[model samples]
Target: GWTYGLNGELRKATRISGIEDFSINVFRRDFGLVPIKVATWGPFVLLNMDNEILQKDNIDTDNVASEWLGSSSELFSLNGVDTTLTYVCRREYIIECNWKVFCDNYLDGGYHVPFAHKGLASGLSLDSYTTSIFEKVSIQSAEGGSKEKEDDRLGSKAFYAFIYPNFMINRYGPWMDTNLAIPLGPRKCLVVFDYFLEASFKDDKAFIERSLADSEKVQMEDIRLCEGVQKGIESPAYSTGRYAPNVEKAMHHFHCLLYDNLIN
Candidate 1:
C-alpha cells in the first residue's frame, strides 16, 4: 500500500510480507507506482491524474466545492444534501448528442421547463425560478408552485446546481440526485443519474417509487430536447444563435468557460 501527496509524490509506502511478496512475484518486474491526486467531498471522490495542472492553475482541491458553490454553499447543507441523505439507486441514459448539449439544456435556468416539461413545470413556480452563476458553478432555484401536500413530490423548494464541466446536483423535496455527463464521441454521451433521499424517507416505498417515476419522466423529456438540438446544430440551416439574456446567462457562462479552457 502507498500514500501520495497532493503534488503526486509518494509520501509513504508499505507492504504486508507474505501477501505482498506473492503479488509482487506475479509480475515479472517490480510494480511501478503511478502518482495521482485524490480528494473527497462527502461521499464523492475526485481524482486527477496530472498534478501539474493543479500546480499550473494554483488550485487547492480542499476548497474546490466551496469555491465553485460560492454564496450558495449554505443551500447544500441547509437541504441536508451530502450529509443526511442515503443513496438509493442509479440510472444511466445514453443521449444522441454532445455532452455539452445536455449541459446547456440544464444551465438554461427554467426557460424550457414550462414548454418542454409541462408536468414538472406544474409543480414548480417558473415565475420564481432564478439562476446564479459562480466561478465554476451555476445554480437554478425555484419555489414550489402550490402549498406543500402530504404527497407532494416537489416539496416547497428546489435547487439545481451545476459544477463545471460535467457534474450536476439537484435537490428538491426530500430528494437529491446527481448527474454526470461523459462524452463517448463527437455526438454521443452517457448521463449517469444517482438518486439519494433523506434517511427518514428510505422506508417509504410508495413515496420513493412515485418520486423516481416523476424524475424519470422529466429526464425522458430532456433527452428528447437535447437529441433534437444536436440534430438542429448539425443542419446547414443552423450556424449560430443568440442567448436569452435573462434566462440563459448560466448557459452562456458555461460556453465562455469552455472557450477559455480551449484557448488557454
Candidate 2:
C-alpha cells in the first residue's frame, strides 16, 4: 500500500504467472523506487510503497497491470501451513536477593522437599527417595515412586527432575508436571506448572481444566514461599546457610554445580 508521498506513482498487481526479472526492473524504472519490504505470509505478497508517488500517479493495483501489460508476470502461489507452534508464559514479582540464592534452593529436592514441600513430601515418604544424576540433569524418585498403589485415588508419587540452567520437571503420579523457576532478572522469576492427563481423558475438557486450575494454585503457593525466601537471603547478616543432609540435597546439588561453573 502507498503512503502520502508521490501518490499514484506506486502500484501493486496480481498476475496469472510470476513476473520476470527484466519485467520487474522495467516496472521499477517507471515507479522510480524499489520495494522496501516484500513480505509473504501464506499466499499473499503484501507490498508497501512511498505515499506521495502513489497519489501523484493515481496508482492502484489496476494501474500496474495496465501500465505493464506484458506476458512476463505469472500467478501468485503459496504452500500450506507456513507457520510454527510455540508456547510462552510471563509473570513478574518482587524479589530481594541475588537470584542465584533462589536457584540453589530449587535445584535439589534432597534438602527442602522434606521441609519446604512438607505436604508434597508427606504423600511420598522421603525416606524412600533416591537421587539419580546425569550430566546437568538429576531426578529424585521415591523407591516405589513409579508403581501405582492399590489405593491410589489422589494419585501421588514423589519425583523431581532438574533440567539444568533453570527448569525443573516435577512429576506427581499421572497428575502433574511443574516447569519450575525461570528467572526474570537478577532477583525475580516466573514458574509454570503443566499437568498431564491419561489418553482416555483427552476429550474431557472439564477434567483437563480442573487439573490445570489445581496445578496453578499449587504454583502460586510455591511462588509466595520462594519470594519470602528471597527476602530472607537478602539480610546483611546472612552470607551462607547450611543444608539439611536429607532435606536440602537439591539445593546443595544446585549450588555446588553453579559454584563449579562460576569458578571455572
For residues 1-264, write the lDDT of model 2, one tens digit per residue. Answer: 432234333344446236565354454456555434334432224354656553554335544422221221111011011122111223343444345655665655545556555544545665776665555556666633334432131254445666555665544434434354556677765554444444455676675566555555545555666677777777787787566765556566676778898999
TM-score of each: 0.82, 0.53
Q: Given candidate 1, what's the lDDT at residue 223?
A: 97
**What's the lDDT of the predicted structure labeled candidate 1?**
0.83
lDDT score for residue 191 of model 2: 54
Best by lDDT: 1
| Model 2 C-alpha lDDT versus the unseen true structure | 0.50
Candidate of highest TM-score: 1
The RMSD of every model to the true structure, in order and in angstroms, is: 6.0, 16.4
lDDT by residue for model 1 (1-264), tens = 666555545555576446645454343234435545566666577676676753454457768567546666776676656766799999999999999999999999888998999888888888999888888878889888776432277888888889889999998888889999999999999999999988889999998998999899999999999999999999999989899998998999899999999999
Error of 2 at 236 (Å): 1.7
Q: Which 10-residue window of candidate 1 scores lowest in summed lDDT?
A: 24-33
